[model samples]
Target: MKAEQKFMMIFRFTPNFKYQPTEAEMVQMQEQWGGFIGNIAIQEKLISTYQLGFEGKQIAADLSVSEGILISENKTLGGNMVVKANSLEEATTMAKDCPILKMGGTVEIRTITPMGN
Candidate 1:
């Protein structure tokens, strides 16, 4: 059996990003996202996925907390999904179909290292 590893894809997008699509367009995009994730689930690769809420707070190094604001175009973490794959390349290939990419968003793939006992 092939060794499998878990990866987390961190999604980021511009705070000003907006989708002003028609009803049909909206439906199409929704279907696309569903299809993309559904396929992975069928393959037993999808672990979990969820959309992040916009309202959040930020903590500074000094432990100062403030309302979360987009510090940069790619600073806001929009969402994330965890998946299992045989390799980083495979995980990256899987993330290529993420709907966020079409919205000018970014996905940062990182391996989920096992915790030391």
Candidate 2:
């Protein structure tokens, strides 16, 4: 039987604006999230994981130059993830453990299509 291929997974998260988690709370949250992803990794379902910073906070547009630049000195409000899976269903299933859901966050999963499609 042929082995299943992996694909890049991107998770879109919207934090609960009502409750802001402190640094310590964020650490705990990260631990739980890591544990969840680690479990999937053990099953050979996850290849990698990442937490993306808030979009707006990361990008700064220069009106004079009409260009966008990355600004690392800002506070981020949201996060994202990247994973590998055989199919969309698998990715969706792996996303079930995301801690953001408990705090009213949302997840968006999409497959990364290779080049030359």
Candidate 3:
């Protein structure tokens, strides 16, 4: 039988508090998940991994843009990862170790349905 392909895994992070997570906290969180990520990488299941920075920090002020009245703030949903797996169950099992969830973070797992070329 043909094996099921891997899919995209999205992690939604929401701070328990309104403020940004402290550097130490972020480090701790990453450390907690480091083993899991490493395991997946070794298994060649991890396709890509990304840790998003603070959205508020990317904002820029430009007087010519909108008279400094209208500002643009880059808002991101959260961090994400892509993995190869035989089934959603396998993917989910791999995601169970994500550290974000320990910090009250949420993860959304979805399959990557490819479009015909």
Cα RMSD (angstroms) for every candidate in the order listed: 2.2, 5.7, 6.1
lDDT of 1 by residue, 1-117 (tens): 679999999988776547567899889978988998898999999999998887888888999999966557456788889999999999999999998898888899999977898
What's the TM for model 2? Answer: 0.61
Off by over 4 Å in 3: 16-24, 56-76
Pairs that clash in candidate 1: none
Residue 35, model 1: Cα distance from true site in angstroms: 1.1
Residue pairs clashing, model 3 = none
Clashes of 2: 0
Residue pairs of candidate 2 with colliding backbone atoms: none
Q: After superposition, how far is residue 42 of candidate 1 from its true place, in Å?
A: 0.7
Clashes of each: 0, 0, 0
Q: Across residues 17-105, which tens digit of lDDT does each residue of candidate 2 receive?
A: 48887999989987988898788878867666666543432232663332332323332235455566667787788788777778665
Give the residue spans of candidate 1 off by over 4 A. Answer: 17-23
lDDT of 3 by residue, 3-65 (tens): 868677776654333577789987886777788789999998888988765443333466323
C-alpha TM-scores of all predictions: 0.83, 0.61, 0.69
